[model samples]
Target: MNAIGIDELRGLAMLPPTASGHSPFAEPCLLLRLGGTAERRLADWLRQLPCPVIGIGEADAPLAASCDVVVQNEQEAQPLLAGVRRSPVAATVLVQLLRASESLPVADALTMESLAYATLQGGAEFRRWLEGRPAPPVPPAETGPAVLLAREADTLRLTLNRPARRNSMSVEMRDALVEALQLALADDDIRRVRIDGAGKCFSTGGELDEFGTAPDPATAHAVRSLTVPGRLLAACADRAEARVHGACIGSGIEFPAFAGRIVAAPDAWFQLPELQFGLIPGAGGCVSLPRRIGRQRTACMVLGGKRIDARTAKDWGLVDAIESSR
Candidate 1:
């Protein structure tokens, strides 16, 4: 890995995209250390590069967008840089694809993510991880509703009901969530939809057992496009309020993020851990979170598998505010 200043980066950007075997874009990651402010226009050029950009210090507002992710100093960046080196293809390709989809429509962005995630799923990295971990367990049929719905006069309250599973987003849960959100979309009479969960955590993530069961990458992509509850939650975003508690992870945070307002309990923490399994945020997180916080911060979480506690989440605009424990 190499670190470059603003002036050198501008010069490097002038090179043609296919400028021989020495193209800067061919590297796994690059550290950008800007002593002062940078030209906002440079962000456009930076995004076009296929490599991951790590903003080092004093990134300033304008230059922050150009960084795929950032750290205040070099010491904090070692693990991230090492991760990029270990899985260079996933690190570089995932951010490149994420930046490309940042400005797209919600549905289109999700479809792009689904396709990319599926591609990664069938790749060597995911296979490598899968071979090492225990095979995901299969659970019996749901004996109860995954989501509990109750009408409170003008408001409809939806609760994630799978405490035993820590509210893992099973197929039943996704279907139930979509149907509930659709009601909000169809009826003007429903003034508000309050969504929360019933367990120690909102949801851990997607059902693990189902991870390797999809017949093929294409089929998985198609299924994700059809059943993604995040898209439906986005459709009713205006009327939705997600009150989350405990762990808001993977689909846990991915689903709630689409809500117009998200209030977090004191213990709430957010994370996106799909990358460890060589998958990207297949759940609309790439689209929704970047829209909420910004492209760089969202990339930081997904790429680094970092956790954001409630206070940090609020400060970063990942959540609307932190609420009292009550």
Candidate 2:
């Protein structure tokens, strides 16, 4: 992908807005040439343009704050813009970043920007894959308990137990998790709550077979907002810890991020592939991930569709510690 030049960027800004209020450039990205001083009018225009703007040149705190991304020079801007231009939803993600910036904290704005990009990129890829592809057969729902409970001393240990599906977070699993958290919260004797998963991998995220099976978007939203364990874990974060191993995808990483401490095995790897399905991180990842690593890195992980190893996860402050695999 070619780096968007200054002249091209200016032309894009001059173009008429779409009926839905978006830029003309299908993959709009602004390369702002910021010298020593802050350009207020330029900044205002950049903000209004529906695309991610990268301010290249001298560092100006105020000016930097206004732009979605800032770099030292054209060289730095090239790779970043190349990556952005490759995303099918680059323009849409920029628009979302601008809106999120207005009301959210700086960290949150960055996080949202990354998520928006990831969502669009993922969604587009998913659609492409679906084209001419036969619908996959849905597996029969697993029976028996989805969560296993064990008491040790003053700690309540909850293990996700559907190994057949690699402990995918089925609705039953989510409900069971919430129930166990509630139980632990109610008992003063339970001073701590430990969460882990059974089988080869911790989890592969929410049940793929169950996607779009919800009666309606509103109902799904209600279940996610009201009943998901992400919220419960957050409320009692200080008393909660997660021991994660193997692949921790999407909600697997999102939920554990809320725990006061997250311990990852040496072989553990993390990813957020929700956007690949044309969706945001619905499992409180929008909140938890950004809080842990800041938005820029989160965006890279989500938008790049990259898997982060335990070492990288630790360096980014996503996991509190990494333990040697047994």
Model 2 steric clash total: 1
At residue 311, candidate 2 shows an lDDT of: 98
CA shift at 33, candidate 1, in angstroms? 1.5
Clashing pairs in 1: none
TM-scores across all candidates?
Answer: 0.91, 0.75
Give one digit per residue, the lDDT tens place, for model 1 in 1-326.
66788887677767753351222236667787856556655677777666678888754645765788888888877877766665666676678777889888988888888888888878887778778898666664456788999998889999998888889998889999988888878888998999999969888989887777788898988998888999988888888999999988898998899999999999999999877876778888888889998888887887778788999999989899888751
What is the C-alpha local distance difference test score of each model?
Answer: 0.81, 0.69
- lDDT per residue for candidate 2 within 206-252, as digits (tens), equals 88766666665555554555576877787788999999999999888
Which numbered prediction scores highest in TM-score against the true structure?
1
In terms of lDDT, model 2 sits at 0.69
